[model samples]
Target chain A: MIEIHDLHYRVGAAPILSDISLSLPEGSLTALIGPNGAGKSTLLRLMARLEPLQSGRITVEGLDLATTPTDAMARTLAIMGQQNSVASRLRVRELVGFGRWPHHQGRPRAADREAVEAAIDAFGLQPFAGRFLDELSGGQVQRAFLAMTFAQDTAWMLLDEPLNNLDVAHARALMARLAQLVQDTGRSVVAVVHEVNYAAAWADHVVAMKHGRIVAQGAAEAVLTEDLLSDLYDTPVEVSRHDGRPLVLHHHSHSRIADLSRGRLPDRARLS
Target chain B: MRFAAGLGLAALLALMLVSLGVGAAEISVRQARSDAWTMLVLMESRLPRTLAVALAGAALAVSGTLIQSLVRNRFVGPDTTGTSESAALGLLAVTILAPASPIWVKMVAASFAAMAGTALFIVVIRRLPRREVMLVPIAGLVLSGVLGSIVTWIAWQADLLQYVGVWMSGEFSGVTAGRYELLWVAGLAAGLAWVGADRFAILSLGDGVATGLGLSTASVMRFGLVVVAVVSALVVTTVGMVPFLGLVVPNIVARVMGDNLRASLPVVAASGAGLLLACDIIGRLLIAPYEMPVSVILGVLGALIFLVLLYRRPAHA
Candidate 1:
């Protein structure tokens, strides 16, 4: 389990996160859902120690994040950010092989090699394993990065905007994979998901944030309500049940023509 | 891979023999094999010169590879990043302040100066928005120009222009067995690079990813910076500045082998050594008896290669 206490992050004078505290359960798929500038990525970066904690205490799986060594923390949790600009002549297989670095350091044993191959297979990247990253499309490259993070083989995985650039099919496939990982391997997963339906469909726990504060956090069915989402995003949202889970239907419901015909211009459209 | 390395080794040996035979002193391979005086000349002058050329080339190229990986910019190298120029400044300062200092003292001074200069370059480039790939080397070139002019002005004021001139043109004509042994230290630094090849490769993946992969990015970056500074200082102190050997060799290797330093570093080193040996041979042959500096030949060739790299399809970020 990951625990946070008294976390307050600021950039210069402007606060990014303030007096935040939360606990994430182990062996569950958790989704961090928020609009832009919600500090979802920043919070994840702090937990992973990619960003230094200013006035916060975080512990991941019993190890203090501030005191743990980088290699030790790496074995505990693996993270993949949205922007992976590895601009070099790197093959997809070689890039994924780097995920085994914490385990093998430099000298890869047979077990490490097998793990790399397994990760490549897990992402279904075998067809383009030999190809360079630049040769692949954006979605394919996104999958390759996901494979690399999986090859890390940690107990916890944190991904920031993992679905970016991925088409709908790949996105759904990745969410299914994350769900399967949590169930089959008992590894805890935390992902910042922009698409709420993904979190609605797969996330066991839903954390909704607005203005750097968690507005609601609980089981997916309880937290992803229409009233909470509409309040969280400052826009109308509708939720319907599908396959015994909450399915958010906010896309077509907030049309501009319907709003103008109703004679009151939307506040968000005016500001933008 | 093993076969390629073996073939490279065989070719290097063959080139070393040829380089040892051809020099201003007019000693053939057969003569050196039979005559004792010719053999002494081969061991003392020709052998040292050849080894110095190879070692310096390999060291510069390795430093270039390290800088490129650390900066995550393909265009920057020791020469472009003001490393060589600042080393010259250190050499000049030592020559003017303490003319009787030991060679090692001068090398230490130069290495310290090179480190400071490179650190400044890194700091400046770090603040830069990294999207524009061409801006990095352009920034480096500006830094090099500034550092180089300062050295030149100081040399002129001290009436040490001629001495600085000797250090500026990378010529192996003056290299003797005892004078060129410092290059071995540079060679050792390159060897260290090979040992830590995987770490450096991870480093090229950027700070966040490298950290996520369990690396102390700062420490590894410092290690690489020291390697680059030490290699640059040694090369400048030993044979003056050999421009672009570092930039050209690794790039060509990367084109064929990609940037997996573990698989490609040895090839980068060997190719660097081989290319420098060939260039030095060309320098000796071009103006027979009266030799041109290897820097002159490398300057022209390196510039051509740089242009080609610039116009070629953009490489990965």
Candidate 2:
């Protein structure tokens, strides 16, 4: 379990994340959902130790984040942020091989090479392993980065917006892969997802934030109700059941005139 | 791989011999072997100059590769980091303070100052808001230019401008057997960097990734910066400022061979030696009795090549 208490972050004079306290259970897939400027990325960064803790304490599996050695933490948790921007000249395989650096330092043993190859195979990236990152398309590059993170082989994988720049098929594939990893290996996964439907479909737990504070967090079905969805986004939304999951509908307005024209309103709406 | 490296080694040895053989005195290979005095002269004068060129060439190129890899920026180099300029300033200060100071003393002072300057550049970069890598080099270039102007002004005021000019012009004319020993420090530094090449490559992947991989990014960066400063300062003390040698050689090598530091390092070293040796030969032949500074020739060539590279789409970041 990862526990955060009274986590606060400020940049200059403005606060980014404030008084955030939460416990992430192990062996679960959690999705962080929020509006723009909701501090979702900041929270994720803090959890991953990308940013130092300002006022609170974070512990991963009973080990203190601030006091534990970085290598030890690395072995336990892996994080992939939104911005990649890796040197494009590096080949896909070489980039993935870096995941084994903690284990092998500089010299790669047989196990390291085997792990890298398995990661490549797992991501279905064997065909493009030798190719440079620049040569790959956006979605392909995303998969390569994901492969690199997976090759890290940590118990906890914290991904900040991993689905950005992926096409619909690629996005679904990535989600499916994450789901499979959680189910098969019992690995803990936390992803900051922008699309509600993705979280609705795959997330076991959903945490909602607004204005740098957690507003709601629980099981996906509990926190994803119509009232919470409309309040979270400040827009009216209709929730319907599909495949025993919530399908959010927020696209069109439910105007009385449209309803009357469609002959789906009462006599009062038709007369008006 | 061994064969290719061996060929490079052979080419480097041949260039070294050719460089030592041709000079203003025109000592023939046969004549030098026949007389003891001539042999001593050849060994004492030409050999040192050849070694200086080869060592300084390799040092600058290796340092350049380290700096570029550490910052993950192609345009970065020792000169751009203000290291050479700082060394020049340190040498000038020694000349003005103790006009009769030993060359070794001056070199030590310069190395210390150069290291300090590189440390300053790294600290400034670390304090920034973390933008693109290109900004780091640009900032370093501006800092170097500022430091260089200060050194020039001070040299002029001290009336030691002539001494400073000779040292700043990047020439191998002053090299002799005993005086060129300072360059051995550069050679040692290059060796140290080669041994740590893997750590440097890992650090180049950005601090977060390196930290995630259990490497101390700050420690690795400090080591890299020290290597760059030491090699650059020692070379500046021995042969003056050679422009673009560090920047152009590593970049060209990376383009041709790829960014695998283990593979590209030796190539960068060889290419650096070849470039400097060829430039030095041309510098000797163009003026014959009166030698043009190798720095001027290299600066012009390096600038042209750098511009060409800028126009071509970069294959990697």
Candidate 3:
């Protein structure tokens, strides 16, 4: 279990995350979703300890976040952020190999090397393993970074905006991988996702955040409703059943023609 | 990698031998007529000059690699960070305060000042938004400019401008066996840098990544900076100022290699030594007997390469 209680993070005078509390279950695929500026990434970074907790308590698998040794913490959790601008000259395999640093420090054993190879294969990156990161396309680079995170082989994985630069096909492939990771290895996963459909399709749990606070969190069907999403984004949203899963759809509001016939543009059509 | 390193080593040896032969006293079989005289010249000046040039080049280049990694900016090095400038200022102060102080005292003072200068750069960088990535290095260059003016003013006020000029214009003519021994410490610092290469490499990935990997970034950053300070202080005290040695050599090596410090450190050291050796040889030949300092030669060459690197592509933040 990962527990966060009364967590608050501030930058200068502005609060980035406030009064957050949650218990994340083990072996679950948890999706964090929110509109822009909802503090989703900040929340992810805090849980990963990438951002310091200003005031609160967080425990991962009975280890206090405040006092756990970094190396020990690393053995339990691995995180990949959106901005992974490491030197592009590094080979794809070498970049993936860095995931083993926490375990090996500097010296690698046979098991470590094999783990790296397995990760490379898991992402189907074998063909480009020898290629430098700069030579890969944006989506390929994203996959390579994901492979590195997986190579850590931690029980818990935190990813912030991992789907950026990935096309629909790649996104589905990654979601499938994440689902498989949860089901096969029983590793707990929390991912910040922009597209709610991806979350609706694959996530067992959904965490909705807004204005630095958690609005709701539960099973995907319970939290991802038409009323909630419309209010969450300040735009009308429609949710319908698709293969027994919620599929969200919204396009410029259903009142567009009525407003247009009234001799005025729809509210959402304003250029300003 | 082995072949390139071997080739570089071979080139360095060849340069050292040729450099050992270029001076006024022709060290040859003819000079064997007086073995004592030839041996004395070789021991007293020639060998130390070659060794000092090699050590300084290697030290400064490794220092450059560490500084660039420490600041997480490719453009930053001793020249831009005010490290060399502060070192010069410390040397100037000692020269003014104790005109007759021994070389060790001056070195101590310069090391202190250089560390202080780098600390300032770190503080400034800590406050930077980091989104405006180029601004960090530009700020470092600005800091260097400020420190340079202070050094100039102090030199001008004390009527010791010539002494300051000699310190700023690096050369090997004055290096003797005992005078350049501090670089041995600088050399050891470079070796330590290589030994701790992975720490620095991960640090270059940025604090978030390093901390996420469960590494204590603060201590590693401090250690890297200590290496940078020692290298800058020792080299400045021993050889005046060798501009762009840290910036250009490490960059060229990293371009061929990657920025993985473990893999790139020794190569950076070798490339730096080779480049400085080449520059020193050119200085000796450019106006034979008149003998230009390597700094003057490297200034023009380093500037040209730095400009090319700058115009080639946008640097990562």
Candidate 4:
């Protein structure tokens, strides 16, 4: 379980996060959904302790982030940011091997090597194991990073926009793998997801943010209503059920254009 | 990799022997006449100078690799951080304050001043918004300018300008058994670098990942700064400013072998020694007794290579 209390983050004069307090249930695959500039990434980064906390307290399990040692925190929680570029040109396997660094520090034992190989196999990266990161496609790179995060073998995984540039099929595959991890391994996950449908399909819980605060958070079904999403994005939307999950309908601007064609009618007629 | 390293070492050994023979002394290479004069020249001048060149080259190259990795910048080196200039200032202060001080005092002062300069550079870098990778080296160059000018102005006023540019324009002509001993300390810094190679590689990945991986990014960066300062200061104190030796050597090594320091650091050291020794040879042979500074040749060659590196940046880069 991860708990954040009275978290207020300010960047210069602008308030990035304002007294945002929330508790993420343990072993739940949670989705963080918000419009642009809603501070979704900031909240994730703050929880991960990637950014220093200004006025807040975060705890993973029973350990407080403020007082816990970095190595201790690393053992329990692993976070991956959107753009994790390696200045060193490393192969996929080598990059994944670094995930065991916290465990072995540098010297890899037989177990560590096994974990690295398992991570590669887990991500279906065996074919590209020897390929440099630059040689992989964007989706492949994202999967490679995911493999590294998995290789950490922590209780919780915190990801900020892991599906950022991945295509629909790749994104689905990643979410499915994440779902599998949560179900089979009981690893808690908190991801900043852009495509609301993916969140609705995979996330057991959803936290909606707006204007630097949690607008709503609960079981995925309870919080992902049409009214909530429409208000969250400030755009008209519809939510309909698909395969027993909420499917967000956001492509409505064309309907307005069609309504304009509702035949008041002959002001501009085509050749037809 | 082992084969390449062995080849490099063998070539280096052959070159060391040739360098020993090519000096101003008329020592015969013939095995029959190993007389006192020949022994004296080899021990007192040729051997020490050659060893000093090797030490300085390896130290500076390791220093360059450390800085570039820590900063995550391809263009960064010890010079970019004003480390050498600050060290030069330290040496200048010692020269003026106590002209009779031993070489150890001067070396200590230079390294201390260099560490201070690097600390200030870190503070400045932290305060500024990090929008560009190029900004770091530019900031370092500017800081070097300011620090270097202070040394110049003071040296000029005191009429002790003779000591101002000791190692900046590198030459092996002045190296002898006693004068170049500080370079061994620089060699120690290189060994420390080798031992800490994994820490550097992890830190090079970036702050967030490094932190996430439980490594203290700040301390690792501090370690890198100290290594850079110590190596550059030692080299500068012993040999003067060897411009671009650090920048050019480490980069060429990284191009041939990737930045996994554990695997590549020894190679980097060898490449650095080979390149510097080669440059020194060219400088010596070009004018013979007249002697051009090795720095001059490296400055020209490094600039050309740098341009090529910039234009031919990897497609993924």
Go through the candidates in order and give each one's DockQ.
0.62, 0.45, 0.47, 0.54
Error of 2 at B186 (Å): 0.8
| CAPRI band for model 4 | medium
Better TM-score candidate (1, 4): 1
lDDT by residue for model 1 (B111-210), tens: 9999999999999899888777778889999999999999999999999999888778888889998999999999999999898898898888788788
lDDT of 2 by residue, B77-100 (tens): 888888899999888888778868
lDDT of 4 by residue, B112-199 (tens): 9999988887777766665565677788889888988888899899987777865556777899899899889899988898988888
lDDT of 2 by residue, A1-272 (tens): 88989999999999999889999878888999989899999999888888888899999889898998888888888888775565636678988988887777778899989999999998899999988777788788878877878888888888989899987888888888888888988989999999887888888889999989999998999999977887898765556667898776653544843653454543432232
Between candidates 2 and 4, which one is better according to lDDT?
4
- The worst-scoring run of ten residues by lDDT in candidate 3 chain B lies at B308-317
The fraction of reference interface contacts (C-alpha pairs within 8 A across chains A and B) present in each candidate is 0.61, 0.43, 0.46, 0.54
lDDT per residue for candidate 3 within B1-317, as digits (tens), equals 68977887898888888878778666772464579888788888888988999899999999999998888778877878999999999888898889799888988899889989998999998899876678888999899999989999988998988877887889998987788888888999999999889888777777777877788998998898888888888888888888988888877877777777788898898888888988998998899878989999999999999888878743442
What's model 4's interface RMSD, roughly to a tenth of an angstrom? 1.6
Better of 2 and 4 by TM-score: 4
Candidate order by decreasing lDDT: 1, 3, 4, 2
User: Candidates 1 and 3: which is better by DockQ?
Assistant: 1
Q: Candidate 4, overall lDDT?
A: 0.83
The CAPRI class of candidate 3 is acceptable
- Lowest lDDT sum, 10 consecutive residues, model 1 chain B, at B308-317
Give one digit per residue, the lDDT tens place, for model 3 in A97-157: 8889999999989999999999999889999998877677878888888888898889899
How well is each residue in A61-102 modelled by candidate 4, as lDDT tens digits? Answer: 989998999998888988888764555766788889889888
